[model samples]
Target: MTNTPTHNRERSCIACGAKASKADLLRIVRTAEGISFDASGKLAGRGAYVCSPECFDKARTGRLSHALKTKVSNEEAQVVAQALQAHIQRA
Candidate 1:
């Protein structure tokens, strides 16, 4: 995967419906395998981008599933939510 620069990558915010460069957002991808962060930003799979950890809750609620065209269970969403929460707390 390519850790491509976020420049020029127009990613829409899942919560607010705002558009911005991918560099300004975090991406979560739902591939054939499972769910994971698109850290490299060049993974080949279905993707949904959010503005930040704050938006994670909303994304996991239904926005993410809607965007990815899949089901995101509450438990699965909580995992990501807590993980992100911890990361944000660390920051």
Candidate 2:
């Protein structure tokens, strides 16, 4: 018998419009506190995905706020960007 591996779930980056595996992307969640990175991908709130720091920067302009249906302040955007960058470096 032959065995095959199933493909991981796919999601589109809000910034670049590139498609990638959900696990390969970073998830940003909108909650009562505000917009933040959801590393577990299981946060209970609206979520958006981005493929890289560049895409994250693009999203910060407006796409991210639109996706979350809430205004994202510059500080919030900066925090998320920094968090993603740190995450990328760690990985």
Candidate 3:
């Protein structure tokens, strides 16, 4: 038998509050430049996760800004939304 890790890092969706594995969710990172989607999940900054586009929409209203502890303007939110949409399409 081969040894393997059983526990996976779990994260909660900022908008829906649903718990899911890190790999199953999309990560959004907040950096000095601005907040954006982290496709690689390795960005060096504060991160938030969302499980679906619906959750993302909810987050766009307010949860995301609160979770990131930063003010996300309309333009920034739009850009993030588009990026996430594209990422989802690719997947």
Task: List candidate 1 segments past 4 Å from native.
Answer: 1-7, 86-91
* Model 1's TM-score against the true structure: 0.75
Which digits, one per residue and each the tens of the lDDT, describe model 3 over residues 1-82? 9453677687899988898889999999999999899999999998999998778988886888888999888898888899
Off by over 4 Å in 3: 1-7
Candidate with best lDDT: 2
User: In terms of TM-score, which candidate is strongest?
Assistant: 3
RMSD of each: 5.8, 3.2, 3.2
Preferred candidate (TM-score higher): 1 or 3: 3
What's model 2's lDDT at 4?
36
Q: Distance from true position, residue 1, model 3, in Å?
A: 22
Segments in model 2 whose C-alpha atoms lie over 4 Å from true places: 1-8
| TM-score against native, each model | 0.75, 0.88, 0.89
lDDT of 1 by residue, 1-91 (tens): 9576666668788988778887667777887876766666678889888877778776787789998888988877777677666655665
Of models 1 and 2, which has the larger lDDT?
2
Taking the tens digit of each residue's C-alpha lDDT, what string does model 2 give over 13-57? 999889877898999999889989998899999999999999999
Question: Candidate 1: minimum summed lDDT over ten consecutive residues — where?
Answer: 82-91
Ranking by lDDT: 2, 3, 1
